[model samples]
Target: MMLAIDFVVVAVIFVAAVGAMSCKNLVSSVLLGGLASLVASYLFLRMGAPDVAMTEAAIGAALTTVIFLVATRRTQEVEE
Candidate 1:
């Protein structure tokens, strides 16, 4: 049962990764990246590393995503 759940989480992560790479919108891509990180945290928790999972969720998914989004927001797009 756990193995099957792990496989599903892995699949979701893979899909989110690919979606993040291929996305045209910066916000959507960032969101997908966050989703992948969040799912990875769940995987870590399932693998018996609660500390690692919490760190991933707090830093990777939340902090990184917020930073990227804020960076993008502060940028000015120039059309040539």
Candidate 2:
């Protein structure tokens, strides 16, 4: 059951990452990237790595989102 849960979590992380990378809009992409990081952190916790999960959640999700938002604010958003 734990393995199954891990698998599902990993799947969600993968989907979220793909969405982030492929998204055209800067805001949507950053949001999805942060979501992927958050999901990945949960997966790390399930795998018995709480410390790594915490770091991932902080750096990958929170810090990264802040940086991306700052960068986005400094430039014009490109349209596809």
What's the TM-score of every candidate structure?
0.92, 0.88
The models' CA-based lDDT, in order, is: 0.95, 0.89
Model 2: lDDT to the true structure? 0.89
Candidate 1 per-residue C-alpha lDDT over 1-80 given as tens digits, one digit per residue, 9 for 90 to 100: 98999999999999999999999998999999999999999999999999999999999998999999888877844321
For model 1, give the 10-residue run with minimal summed lDDT: 71-80
Cα-based RMSD of candidate 1: 1.9
Q: What is the lDDT of residue 30 in candidate 2?
A: 94
Cα deviation in Å at residue 79, candidate 2? 12
As a whole number from 0 to 100, the lDDT of residue 19 in candidate 2 is 91
The TM-score obtained by model 2 is: 0.88
Query: Candidate 1's error at 54, in angstroms?
Result: 0.7
